[model samples]
Target: MASGLCENCSQLRELTAHLRKVCREFERKIRNVFREFSECNCVRITPERSFLRTTQELPSLRLLNDDETQLLSQESLQALNKLAVSENTGLQMSAAMHYLHLSHLLKSPLPDAFMEPVMALLLSTDLDVQKTISLALVNLLVKNNVCKELVIEMGMLVPILELFQSGDSAAQCHSCACVAMLASSESNKDAIVVDGIIPLLALAKSYDPRVQQNATWALLHLTQSDGSTRILCQAGAIPVLVLLLQSSDSEVQFCSCTALCNIAAIREHHPKLLSIGGHYLLKSLLTLMLSSVQKNSAQACRCLQTLSKNVLIQEQLMELDCVLPLKALLKTSAAVWTEPAVTLLSALSAHPPNNDFLVSEGLLDEVALLLHHHRSSSAIITHSCVIITNLCSSRMGQQAVMESLCLSGLLGALLSPGLSDETLLHVTSCLNHLTTWSEWPGHPLNLSAAITAEQVSGLVKMSGQIQNSLLSCNCAAIISKLEMTEEIIGLLRPHYITMSEYLLVFLKKKDVKFQHLGIVTIFNLKKDGDFSSLLADSELEVELRKVHAQTEETRRLLQMIQPLSPSSVNP
Candidate 1:
């Protein structure tokens, strides 16, 4: 009997030790909970502090248990609702929402039940509270996969839409973003459009630049649907967009311009945009490209590029005298404007539709002059050469090309061993365009003697530095135009290995221009019998494989040649 009693005592001792171990573990867990919760000391509430303490002290507290996360969520929701209505406590509520957001506890926080309170806070007189509540609602919807139906069921869309008209720009911006996020869902887009998104966009135009910017982004997102572009046009978005382009804020200008780009991207909407003040806006945008501020000018240039490529827009632009500003921009000291200037000039000069406009505007002589005088910097010279090449591609352009007496200057630039790869590329491309245009069936001039044996000699002297992909492509283009098979073959013989290496490297670049130029060069080179012998060289075969693969892709998507549009007159 004594032994049995001793066994029971031993079992009791073991039970006591086990209980102590469990208690210690529970205490450590509580401490950890407190540590994490306190990390966000940004939240300050007497009741919240007490609740946190209670949960920490009783590690096994029902409220602290994951199983009870839903219940705690209910309690937190009630607290938020009450605090949201209390003016003095709104900041605390915001802090709590932030903490909940950061902790990713929204899914467990009974989002559906809190929707009404959030909608109410969104209409609060306090801007800060309104912004916070709107952000929290967005977080709730995004985090919990809450449907737009849930929002509509709670009768929240109206109030949210009302927030777009709010005087507080921050609140309005957030509301627009939230609406945009909701509208992205196919289910939500139709309702958003039907519920007067168009009128709201018009209203947003008058708001501060930040609000306008956000609203434009939201409108762009909404207009991504079919038939929405027409809706936007009918709702007078174009006029507002044009006005917004004149905004001093670069961001507002960019967003507005980008919206125009999207509008133009839709083929059916192109005519509508032109009818609805697109032409005048293009002129204004071109003027902006001449802004002393670099940012403003760059934004304007991008906008013009977008509009210039559209068939309807190009025709419209060509009717006006856009060549003057374009030429002026090319000669402008702003290096940033140089590329767009060249691009515009090239586009205008290359398109048959704009050839007459360019000639009538005396653009060819101006372009030729720039080409002749701007060789101080290789980039400037190269860009000028591209412009001239574009000019020379047309009958009128060739007439001007021949009349300008600048071909000799260009050929000299290409032969100069000191020219940068970029300069050489540009000069050779210009020469190629001039030669090709001159050789056409009804051509006005001949460049056959212009690129004669002396020219080949000059080109060969720089063959070492000209081994780069860019310059090699330029050389090939020039040779193709001149049809200098033997001369090109001789140049490639000594540098087959280097040529192949550079060609392969050039094909891998992300730049489309580089790829296009490289492929064209290869195609021209292969036309010459020397290319076959060059390909026979063992070292070039692998590089040739890569080049062939890239060239095939490029050939499928041939270079697009767009004409200049009629110039828009600035009011």
Candidate 2:
């Protein structure tokens, strides 16, 4: 963090680090020699001036026998305490350097006493003292988490936050780094955000690259708080973070992008972030993804994933034609890109415009790839099913899915053993959508028969599982798409009681769509009269007679059903 040091100063930098780790006796001898040298000199020796003078005179060191020397002796801790508050600017610099060195070299938690000097020197006029102490606090507080509450007790965050507005760039950079560490702790999150966030939003736009980078990182950590999103958005954090998305540094882009994602994740935060040229943020993230900055690309997709949740942001994404970056990311050999890309595609597919575009570009291929490659990942499988479900609404999507390997993968995902219910719901929903214009000898009906006949025993066994509404509904839905031959009907005839029960429950659903799905599938299976007789032989008609929730569709099905035979005579 000590920038602008001369070549000799850089060499002396190693000696300065070494000087902290030497034995207590050697430290005493060095301090005595230092005081004598300072007193003997006509010019008061600043730490920087002393360094320049010492770098010339002391060129060699006999490596100390490291047998018993521990870092930072008791006398050195005493001298550090005195030097930290000394009026001499040079002494403060030396203490600040030792602050950094001791924090790094010591094996344990930094001593509690060292924080006193940190609090005292925070307001120093000397830039070196400010930068070095800020960096040291970052080591002690951020890297080690030694004094988070203690820092709050000392109110160190206030002076640290001020550095962004009032201190030099190096001070701002390290102060920003320090704030990021503080913001990561739960106890400090609310207190830090109260006074600290605005400067971070402001400092993110600083012309200094390091300042911009650290400020962006700080913003990323600040977002770990659930409350920070609104504060960040209201302070105009979005546009500035979006600008940082274009930074030449990939790390800057990654941090800014992830920060933008955290803000964008909450739906209520969308209007504030999107209303002010949010479209450009979407565009820049996509551009970075296409440019193949791998880390940036991954985070950029995450930003896209979170932003796409808002329908309005989805509209903007549709305009940007995000499918290019989506497919590019999906096709990349890296497994890391699969989940985010498909997840974004799933969210985008909810919007009809984006859905159709994704279909045209053959985004189904990516969905199929994820299904095939990441079957063990329920999230990947779930989102893949959602993409298929959404895309199936489009006729072009239907043909694309049917004509390619995607259909096989879709079926494989659906029947995948032990798939979670959330995933099973998506897979079943996709099949229901795929059958909207169901035709035999083609995509799903034949595909269903080929897959279902192989598992008819599973289907029938599943049909008895009416207690599981998803499995029962999927079985009924799959039957609706089958050829409905006597063979299929007979296969369903064994679970006669459970099938009729499933239909009755389905008919009673509040949504008319569910009622229609239930009645229509029951009517389709009525062909052989065996399954129909199972219904006719039950008390279903008597049950219907007592119900008042029947819609026109349910009534129409009953009119067709009542002609089968007499109702069951059981109690």
Candidate 3:
């Protein structure tokens, strides 16, 4: 019985030993599979298995998860540091660095310790890697926002600026985008300019179109601030941009045009752009506004809009025969061109010199044609009518506008129930301008009287009908101009409460003319004691005092307009 019991104990011990060996083997197999998956996933693994083979069939092994990701990053970075010292390994190191970055993107925020090593990659000899790393850093920095202080502290401006001069288009584009993103902060703008972004723009002129486009875009962003505009102009970016306007690539031309617009946003930069043959280029740009491509036309129009803001540039554009092309574009068959075309014409007609040009070019006839005949979008019709309004606001242009029978169509537009708020405002304002035209050298006062009465009736109807603030302003201005005090007083006699509220609202507006109109309308209505009570109750007296003060201030400024300097004058 003792021998049998001993035999059972021995068998039990052997079974226990066999089970332990099988457990160890199973653990080893699981680890091997994990390592294989990590390597395949391009993640980091433990040092022991990083360079170890998982099987005879597959020579390379990987990590299980984020552990392997970190391992690969450390190894690649170390390799990059070593490879930076040698010429041949530069390419390999670049590839390896990119691989690590790809891995980093797949993971969460990297440990703060990795910032230094990753930034050093920007200084790599391989332009490809330098650009890749620069772009990657920009993405990381913009996304995190926490990297700004750290990146600025690292003194990265010089190396990154040097990349702007790279011959590789992709490299240059990426570098430009990165720098632009970094310089978006106002405080950073100074450092970026000081780092030679302006000079680099000069060197980058010969790059491919994509690079040029990005460089110009970056230059635009960089020059948005007051200080940077001066720096960029001093660095010769204006001339470069003007030349780039002649580029065959529409995209480059568009970017160049946009850059010019930003630069021209600064009033000081305007004359400088004009002095550098910007007018000649502007003529070329106007020619391109006829392009069938919407983007090109839109960009050209935008540039023209910016240029027109400068009195000098506008005069130059007028001297270069810009009005003819602008008029032609306005009258084009394509309705898409109408809005921008009308805007350009409005801006051009706002100035005295260009107004004279428009009159001479028979632009009023063209505008009348659009108002009388063209069936277009309400927005386009509104813009066309507004252009006429702007043109007729000038003394000489108003004669041309009225003689062209613009009043008939304008009155129709104002009285038409289907007219949009925008068109109503435009037609009313045009009437306001023409109502002041008692007589002209070529036309008699009778013609003006007939037109003025028709316009006043239409505007009064509109004032009672439309609800838009701008339309109301236009109606009030026309009423003020026509001396229709009795008519307005009679209209408000029965509904003094509603009239008082509307007049009070109009008086509070910042527009000097509209405010004056409100005051005049109120003073004329005061004949009725009931109207006076309403006006006094609505505080119209205090508002009238404010409007009178503003009018005096405005008149003082207007009286101070000296003859422009020769350089200031557009001709």
RMSD (Cα, Å) of candidate 1? 17.4
Report clash pairs, candidate 2.
Answer: none
Candidate 2 to truth, TM: 0.70
The numbered model that scores best in lDDT is 2
In angstroms, the error of model 2 at 43 is 14
Better of 1 and 2 by lDDT: 2
TM-score of 1: 0.52
lDDT of 1 by residue, 1-571 (tens): 4445577798998899999999999988987876777555553356555444433334322333444354336565565555555555444455335433533443454546655566667656766666776776666656654666677666677777877666767778777767766766666666777665665566556547766766766676666676665777777777777777787777777667767767766677666666744467877777777667666666666566666776555666666666666767766655565667666666555567676667667766665565555555565576567667655555666676677667767865655546666667677767656665565455445554555555665554433343475555556455445444455456545554554555455566566665555555567666756665676654445655666787677776675545355664333
- 1-571: candidate 2 lDDT, tens digit per residue: 7579899998899798887767676877886885676556554456644543442232121112121123344545556666666777876786677666655655567667757778878877777788888887888775563868878778888888878776588888999998888877778878877888788888888889898888888889877677876777776777788788888887788888888778877777777666665466667888988756777787888888887766777787777877887888777666677678878888888877676778888888777887777667777888888888778776788877877666567666765677776776676667666666667345543444545444555554554465676766775676566666656665656666766776677666675555666667766777766766666646665544434454556688887864633455543
Give the worst 10-residue stretch by lDDT in candidate 2: 59-68
Off by over 4 Å in 3: 1-114, 125-128, 138-149, 165-169, 277-279, 291-293, 309-312, 328-340, 360-362, 365-386, 393-427, 435-571
lDDT tens readout by residue for model 3, 1-571:
4445577798998899999999999989987995676576353354323322322123111322345354436554454444344344343354445534544554455455555655566767677667667666766655663355556667777787787667667777777766766667677888888876655576448557767766776676777788887888888888887777777777777767777778777777766776754456677678777666666676777678777877766777777777666776766666666666767777777776566667778878887777765533566567666667666656777667657767666655654557666666666666666666655666743322444444555555555542576677767666554433445445445555555666777777666565667777777666667767766635777877777787789789998998678986866
Q: For model 1, what is the alpha-carbon lDDT of residue 40?
A: 51
lDDT of each: 0.62, 0.71, 0.65
* lDDT at residue 7 of model 3 (Cα atoms): 77
Query: Which should have the higher TM-score, number 1 or number 3?
Result: 3
Candidate 3 colliding pairs: 38-63, 39-62, 43-68, 44-68, 44-69, 45-68
Candidate closer to the true structure by TM-score (higher is better), 1 or 2? 2
